[model samples]
Target: MSYEQAIAALNDQWSQGDMDSDEYALERERLDYERGEMMSAQDAPEVAA
Candidate 1:
């Protein structure tokens, strides 16, 4: 799965209480940063490569 998709699934898991708070927060942070980078790259085409 794509990073965003995986992140979203993790979020769902967290919401469902399937993951602990600490693990959820950490994974959420990782995914949030990754999603930010992905968005930034999308906005700035030169960074995509």
Candidate 2:
């Protein structure tokens, strides 16, 4: 899942009290970084086939 999607999912779980604030923040950070990495890769030039 994308970072934003993951974050939203986490938020849902957080609202349900399935996770604590620290856990949510850590997971959110992880997802955000993963999303950033994916975006960076997409921004890179494509290699010729």
Candidate 3:
């Protein structure tokens, strides 16, 4: 599955109270930051290798 899909699934799990709050928050934050970076890179102009 895609990162976005996986994150959404994780979020659902958290919402269902199956995961610890602190751990969920930390993981969600990490995923969000990484997702943001991926989005940023996608928006950036490509440079020749």
Using TM-score as the measure, which candidate wins?
2
| Best of the candidates, lDDT | 1
Select the stronger candidate by lDDT from 1 and 2: 1
Off by over 4 Å in 3: 45-49
In model 1, state the lDDT of residue 21: 89
Q: Against the unseen true structure, what C-alpha lDDT does each candidate score?
A: 0.86, 0.82, 0.83
TM-scores of the models, in the given order? 0.59, 0.76, 0.63
Judging by TM-score, tell me the better candidate of 2 and 3.
2
Please tell me which model should have the higher TM-score, number 1 or number 3: 3
1-44 in candidate 1: lDDT tens per residue? 78868877998998898999899889888887988898898899
lDDT of 3 by residue, 1-49 (tens): 6787979899899989989989898888888898877777788748323
